[model samples]
Target: MVTNIAKAILSVLLAAVVSGCALGISEIPVAELEKRYASNPPLYIDVDGLQVHYREEGKDNDHTLVMLHGILASLHNWEVWSRELAGRYRVISLDLPGHGLTGPANFEYNTENYIQFINSFASRLGLEKFTLVGNSLGGYFAWNYAIRYPQQVEKLVLIDTAGFPLKKIPFPVRAFTAPLLGEISMHFTPRIASSILLREVYAEPSRISEAMTERYYELQLRPGNRRASQTLFKRNLEILRQEPSGLEQLTMPTLLMWGEQDHWIPADPHLKRWQQALPHAKVVIYPDAGHMPMEEIPVRSARNLHQFLSGAEITDTSE
Candidate 1:
């Protein structure tokens, strides 16, 4: 009877092992992913002890447009805007500390670290001052950087910025911002999830294409990218409080753009606070767009940006 009991115990242990294995993450070949995704040859620089990758385009003699992209997004996301704006101005976009071709460094992925890197990056590039433009997380950095280094930012553009305390945070954002919960997803490759998340950001789902999915998937798997992502998301919840505290200090000429259908950040409540804080701000709301107006409706947004940058009073085109 004792022998039979021992055999039963072994069977139960094996069952438990199988059950755990059932939830194991699938293995992907990083080599194959990189071959297709790492297409762009990047210009390199050493900023804040990190080897940074960036793309510099447009005329050297023209005024500069220094662009920053959102969380988990790379310099590639600004490809369309950079191309369109480069014709008129010097356009430079960089992969943030832990995003894109740029590898991770030993620093907290918080606003302070990002702002320091931005300052160092501009100084290295000999950019005394330039128009600062950012989307989502990048926008949060842009506005704050304006406050911190008002001397270095000539103008400010915020696209669905994330500096305020969100009244109703989205499911994916809430999940990834939770400490242990988000880190758990770090082990899994994000190719499929990237597509899903991209879909979530757009009012029209078809905008999440195969090419976009491939790029986001492979770039995210870059060494240390996944871990940095978890750290940034968890730390972002902490920064939201710190972000709004100094909005009044950002007195630069500002342009605020929002997607009316933005699920990530609603336009109505936040815009009111932004206007209250920066009384010298201009606001535009896009009717048929979502979180990513720069991508969702690039040309129309371009018209607006071009007007604003040219010091022309911007007319609302949402009607």
Candidate 2:
């Protein structure tokens, strides 16, 4: 009986290994990714020796809006917002060093390095001052940039930003940060994993279209992106551990937006903490939205942003 049980366990383990191998993903060529995702010719700029993927849209105006996406997300996440705001304001979105088509970076993906990189990118674009907008980890960068370089930022918008220390690391992030598991994950990341993450970010899973999932999964398979993302996760863990400070210094016109259904960075305590820090900030909570209000409910969220920037009364438009 004992010998039979041992054999059964071995059989199950073998089956699991075979299943995992069958689902393994491989890196997609950069050219192919560009063809699928980019315009006639992909827009790229040399920042810190890396060919950074970016998009600049809207009318040529003095008022500029620079948007940043969260970790594991690309500039494409801001497509709706960029389109809605582009008519009035010069909107620019970029794939950060690791995420999106930007792939890996020459320098470290630490806190200070990213801040400097943003500054360099802005300098290259000859942007004197612009409204800085970011979501999730991008929001973390936005607030920090506003705090560090107060004069250059006219306004700040943070959507489910990460500043406060997390009680526990999310499973996906934790898995990618682990030594052995992280290396394994780089090559074996399946499409289902990407879909699950996308659903988690949306309060309603129905909002995640098939094309969106495909884009995310394919981007994760972009050459050099997985390794860079792994490195970023490790660096982010260290940064998240440090207690958040300097928030009180963000006296600029600040707009804090959070999704009430956000599981990643729940609105309860984190929103309250941000409120206390930036008492003057205009706060908006989307009732039916999750971590990404911009992506989940783009139209209403974009309207609120316009109202905030235009100094109009923020109406209760919950969708």
Candidate 3:
């Protein structure tokens, strides 16, 4: 009887283990992801031994605009903006190392390394001077790149950019930074979690489509992408701890585009900080948008950018 009871207990435990294993999310192969995600055959360039994935449109135009996406975001974030602005100005967008199709490389994922990657990428493409635009973490890189290569950056546009001290990281992102929890959390990325994150970033959660959420979830499962995010998140925390130094010194034409509904990084305080630092910079605040105004309100945001580039007077549209 004792032996039979022991066997029954073991069987129950084994069944529970199998059920847990079935629930775990598997990593999506890069090739399969490329098939589903890549709208075109995707272009890549050799930058610092990394085959950087990039897209260039409106190559014939005189002015070049290089755009970058935020953490866990790919160049696809700029699809609407790229299409809208490409006709007017040459638009180039790329998947920075460890994000999108460009998976993890040997280089350390830090601010300096990211800045160098931007410089090297621009040089490899024979781009001498271009307007640099970035969103979220990409904004951090954009401004830093402009500071390091001020002469090379003709103009700088920061869309809900980072680098200013964050009072608190949004919970979804902060969860991925905890030591043990981060590693475990990476393996169980659910589709709904992606949807939740997308909702958090958009002012109107109702606007988030099924396809958009699916894409984010699929890309997060790209092999090694989660691990890279973990590393990047830790590095970013380090960045937030240090004081931001060179905003006032950036004397080039600067444009600050913010979303009034940005909960991840409140628009009011950050906007105040930026305005104080860049008194002469033009500011455009989208009232009904969230963290990513480019994705949320592409038409209006792009129009503001076009106006700024054309040297037209920007009527304050915050109201």
Candidate 4:
């Protein structure tokens, strides 16, 4: 019943309405995060035009332990350990560039980009040297950073890290890394997506909880986070091709914790490579754990980490 001009105008208005609603809903402020739940307030530092978000807990005199979360994960991933370790150590957890409340990096998201972020973050905090613990992508960054700046890292811990190439990629990874398909697929991620991700990450699916799934979903919806995740996924493929030889050069005391049931990076050959490269490294594989051993077996993992950092009686099985 409407004229062509009226229809065109109506169509434009409708499109704008939808777009506006989408953006408005997606734009979640960093400050509002606390209102939703009890979380450590974010400490911000200016770096390359971006306000980096980090949390520091415990006394300043205790040994510093810097924890890095995996890809698509924020500092909240270390909440359990941060609380447990705060009594004995100065625990610091940061949301890497392009993730969590940190926003996006000014430069490309890659290993070198992360290296700069870590160094900058450390310098800003006046951290001369500290123990580094990283998981998954964080582990890769930790290994790279430690290799380049051995003196800056007192000890290193890698959990289900990605450094070497694999013959077969996991289903989720394969789907996430695909071209146009991946972009389209991200919008369709449901509440079940977190469960699927957790299932793949943990050897025991029973370990996953509704609360964990809810946290992941809530964080993913943070302003600009999903786009940044996509950017990271795309850039990581290029970074993986470089094959940094720094692993063989590491001399610091290292701990490798992995889940025996990790589908992403199988424990067999990858662990062997780490063992061979890091002759001084101690390795522990949790039989019931999956890709994220720390979350799956926090007690045992934390004990091992505490012992390693304290220079207790540790066994290096590879030797």
Find the candidate with the highest lDDT and give its number.
2
Instruction: Compose the digit string of candidate 4's lDDT tens values, residues 197-266.
Output: 7777777777778888877766776677777787787777755545558577788889999888887778
Q: Report the C-alpha lDDT of model 1 over 159-197, residue by residue, as the tens digit.
A: 988877887765455556655445555654435567666
Tens-digit lDDT track of model 2 for 1-319 = 3235433543544465667645356689988899888744588999979888999988486789999999889998889998899888999999999988888998988878889999999998999999999998899898898888999999999999999987766656876886756766776776766777786788888898999999999998998888898888887896765679887789999999999998888898889999988899999998899999999999899999999999998875755
Candidate 2 — which residues are off by over 4 angstroms?
Answer: 1-24
TM-score for each model: 0.86, 0.92, 0.91, 0.85
Per-candidate Cα lDDT values, in order, are 0.77, 0.85, 0.84, 0.75
Q: Model 4, residue 164: what's the lDDT?
A: 77
Tens-digit lDDT track for model 3 on 69-119?
998889989988999998999999998898888888668889899999999
lDDT of 4 at 270: 80
Total clashing pairs in model 4: 0
Worst 10 residues of 3 by lDDT: 1-10
Q: What's the C-alpha lDDT at position 155 in model 1?
A: 91
| Candidate 1 Cα outliers beyond 4 Å, as residue runs | 1-18, 22-40, 177-180, 241-243, 316-319
Better structure of 3 and 4 per lDDT: 3
lDDT of 4 at 264: 79
Q: List the residue pairs that clash in candidate 2.
A: none
TM-score, model 4 to reference: 0.85
